[model samples]
Target: MPNWLLPEFIADVLPSEARKMEDLRRKILDEFRSYGYELVIPPMLEYLESLLTGVGQDTEIYTFKLIDQLSGRTMGIRADMTTQVARIDAHLLNRNTVTRLCYAGSILHTRPSGLQATREPLQIGAEIFGYPGIEADAEIQSLALASLKAAGISGVCLDLSHVGVLKALIASDPLAQIFEAQLFDLLETKDMPGLIELTKGFHEDTRTALLALPSMYGDVEILKEAKKILPDTEGIAKALAELEYLAGQAECDRVTIDLADMHGYHYHSGVMFAAYVPGLPNAIARGGRYDHVAEAFGRSRPATGFSMDLRELARVLPAAEKRHVILAPWSDDEKLCRKIGELRQSGEIVVYELPNSRSEHDEFVCDRFLVQEADNGDWILKTAGNE
Candidate 1:
């Protein structure tokens, strides 16, 4: 293989896509900042235990582990930033009042999440800690929607779920609790045959409810049907009510319910959601209430957040227009140099034309030129190719 060949599912972002991704990153971060989410930057990697503290098997499978030379402890390249931000909130910031934090960075996964997915994803997200109400969940969901809107993605559908619904059912019966992991896997895949075989020996009501969960996905009306069929446990009731409220509060084109959605099931403690756009079958972004992560760090704060791969998002967006630039001749003249500096400071892209070379930039088009007036010798701007 050629030395320049990248690994499978990994590729370099060229100038055009990189520009779009950077622009989206800035706009989304600004949207996050506008909501008072203080930006935080965590390390690219951390101790294995710290990275895996409150995440599930999915994240564990994604993380890339390494032996740290300094401490001889296992370190993991972060596949997700949620827990790291939670650690900062629980241990570092140590704020007693409500705290809002946001982060943007690249994360490495051992394998691609989908056939078209990249192993290295640019992740950006925001979290709120110390607030345990459904209102926090609502805010996070709204922020996720707004972030997509900032990126110019439209026709979004918010898919909502709650881990508590399944948690309640499992906790209500010792038999179900014993097979919790199995049930979780089956439900995530919606493997009816497997769920049937696994739940055959359970209580009648437990088996019935477990079977109904997979089919309980649709519009918000599914919540009403869930209320009628599912066990009326306190946990299930609270989870359903929260979903209904968020569905009502969601400011998007559509809202959906998926009672059996087990994404981040082990990681999220309450309502979870994924955003879907028009073209992609997979979710564009995912988030939910994860109040358990801080507990792993010994602070026990309620946290909710969402993250998306900017590269994946950029792939769907239309290509950005080539930036317009003013071609300036490289010169030692003080006035010419000063004029170039002024244009740069004023947010114009001024490219210097080196001697014996033509201007070349893949991401920019030289539509204007800086020239000295023939009569006055004063530097001025003129349209390129006019002369």
Candidate 2:
């Protein structure tokens, strides 16, 4: 066999892990359904152009592309489900009104340089299109919180920031263009000292506000503190007000406002947020308002959405013992086979095996075992541990 069996970042989801992931996926989908967000099973592969329409070129580099022989056009595997749903909403659904769509699928991407982010990630999320307001942001955040609760995650911190606020702060000074890149880098790394050093050239007030940005995290109180420090730019004020309003509306107990949290995705316009749980260094789920993504696709609709990485959630979930029942027939009885088939059809995990050697009927390597009687009678069921 050739040495190269699989690529570096991608790997198989074996039966055990796959089963657990499917269970988590179903639970999340059920939660989304409860919220009236209709499920959408988008195609695994799409046209390269359609997929690359809204999301920037940096994200596009991660996609795996190929030429379609039948259509003689470039096709690419979906690297993100958000853009795919946007295309569906704009072109397929074609409604100017509000729509809630949810999806669960695998998104393929190349491994980032010096990072171990999985190449194939299982994403489950919802998109809200055509809603325009901070109210929409609050609703999405609420839904995301509820979804996490439903998945049995507790003590979640909702890290909220406004993309517009950050952009406005950068736009205020003539030197903004020169310092924008470094400022973004500082925010990404949560480096307060580096930010303080970099902003030394700015006025004292602006410099102090910029320095304090990284630590402006906590409840609604932090929002007030941010307002006091940040220059009274109209955009920044609006963004702060929106965050405060969102905090009031959100019912979650653990909310943190990180004014400096800036993730560089072009689609995120208004507010961006991520859900963090214990044991996971990065966010288990993230989403924000991207009103312009639909417009980039030529439909010009406002949209906001978030996705939970199933793999990350699985890592944090407590190990659940699998329940199994085994079926063993001493004789090749047709009726026994029929019964086993019925149980299997009813969603029971049954394993049919040859008759056991022990006198005990359930002496088998499973949670439970079944045996057929020589006489025409009901089958005997026994717990494996008891036997």
Candidate 3:
């Protein structure tokens, strides 16, 4: 490894990209605030046990851990912020009523999540706590769609799933955790052949429904197909109804269901969804309902939210907007300084030239400058190109 080389999957964000990311962050946060979601900033790291709450085995693998010298306990750098926010809701605030929270921060993953993913991602998200109704799921999904729109993102396709379908089946025929883990891995990969081989001993009805899941994906009609082929149980019926309602309320251009899309198997208890925009190989945003997450923090609260990488969103968005700049000389003239201050206060970027240094900045468009029409006279603004 060379001294100047960065670790694989980690890269620096230059000024232009950072500016765009910040701009979008502010816009999305403002949108969340409008919907009554107050912002909360969680620390980058926490005790290993607390951080692992409400997360799956994969999240633990993705996390980077260290020994805490202060407390002699293991600490883990956050790979995701949702569980931390849940801690705040359950242990700290302990609010019984409905509470909405939002956060923006950098999460460090042990490895890149996808082929084109980053190990360090700036995650921006919002969560609704203390709400368990299907409406809460709908609200979060709608909020995610709105955030993308606020970021100038279009052509978004939202893939929806309700783990309740599978959970219902598992409840009827409980299996050992080890066997369930194998089932989860197979479903995660959508490996139908492997799934068929593994579930060969299951009852005919259960096997048929499990097999039907992989292909029960597409538009809203998939939900209809699911109800027909899957076991006629209360959990399945309820999940199908909830997905149908959420799909209608999503307000997105396209919505579909993936029955076997149980990405958050251990972490999420209800609906799971991923949002994709055109040209992005992986989902730009993902979220779902994790009703049991709060229990890890000592109180079980119904929660739902979504998170997206600001850096990834910035990369796909249009170029950052260029700002007009007024470049002026470094001087002690009180009036000239006052005028520059006024321009800056009025939201214009004014760059002051340093004494005995380079006078030109290629980065900014210096179309205007401060000048004095005559010596000992009032300062005036003039076109730099003309003067």
Candidate 4:
């Protein structure tokens, strides 16, 4: 029971990684601000019912719960920040005009999101409230692209999917009566054999649509193929059109479509997107339209946004530029203190030396130092190498 021992998938961020993550957070939030997205900081936990509402059942297993000492009710440690953001928009702010909000903080999950993933993740995200048009979705996508580029992420392949298409395909009375759980498994895993067997008793079009989904991945033209293969009911056509519009608006080098992509199908009401970089097995970021996520909060608004794990991004991102540092000697001389203050005012990183301690480290390469010149009796600065 060593005190320093953290649970599996939860580890402390040492100085090096912490600095990089903070830099990423600062730069990304600045990018979000430039797009007029106001920053919001939600609490780390909430009542279970409040936290789980409209976030989709798939996320429930990831949330950790405990009895609240104050209220004597079950409270959930947030596994995702998006639901909190939605509640803020609908209940707290209650604004009629479209609102763009962004947030960055840590979320604790009960299970790892992926292989070798951490249960404690620093999540950064943005959300748009009150706008249902494709334009809002486009803005969010463009912002995501810009933020990724700011973080030096390149060679990204943006994968687009619309949950509406799936909903439309299976909305028929006969198809609705079938075992949805089996179909979900087949579609999610792309189990063609199981899908074919399961769809044997389905209608001709339904069977054809279910079987065609797995192969629907690839290129922007997948939308055209989907329109022909999948039924147009339940807003499928509108959904495809929106995806196509976003593809054009995104202006990324590579954009692909997939009709079978159902990662957030349960609560993701419209177009869903995930950004993938070459060689990465999972998407670097993901988001989409979830219109009624705020319904339980008393207002149903059109919302679209994206969130990425800052810890994950820091791993993939290039190191941030460290400030040029000047290591000053451990002295209480008035002239020395004045010089250090002046340098700091001029945007210089002058680390005042501590008693019996080293000021320079791997990141803080002591480029310059302060010294007392015996000849003139005044403290002067000198290069570390020269000294």
Best by lDDT: 1
Candidates ranked by lDDT: 1, 3, 4, 2
What TM-score does structure 2 among the candidates reach?
0.87
Write the residue-wise lDDT of candidate 1 on 1-387 in tens digits.
899998988899988889899999999999999999999999998999999998888999999999999999999999999999999988899999999999999999999897588899999999999999988988999999999999999999999999999999998889999999999999999999999999988988889999999999999999999999999989999999999999999999999999998988988899999998877767899999888887878889988889999987997899999989999998998889999999999999998999989856779998999889879778999997687
How well does candidate 1 match the true structure in TM-score terms? 0.98
lDDT of model number 1: 0.92
Q: Write the per-residue lDDT of candidate 4 for residues 1-387, one digit (tens) a residue.
A: 998898999998877788998888898999999999999999998999999999877689999999999989999999999999999998889999999999999999998888778999899999999999888889999999999998878888899998887677677737644677678778989999998888887888878888998999988888888888887665877988998898887767799998888898887889999998865666889999999898888789999999998888878766656666888878878888898898889888888778887654545666788888888767777986786
What is the C-alpha local distance difference test score of candidate 2?
0.79
The models' CA-based lDDT, in order, is: 0.92, 0.79, 0.88, 0.86
Candidate 4: TM-score? 0.95
Clashing pairs in 4: none
Quote the positional error of residue 254 for candidate 2 in Å: 2.1
Residue ranges of candidate 1 with Cα displaced over 4 Å: none
Q: 1 or 2, which is superior by TM-score?
A: 1
Stretches of model 3 off by over 4 angstroms after superposition: 174-178, 359-363
User: What lDDT is reached at residue 162 by model 2?
Assistant: 86
Local lDDT at 36 for model 4: 99
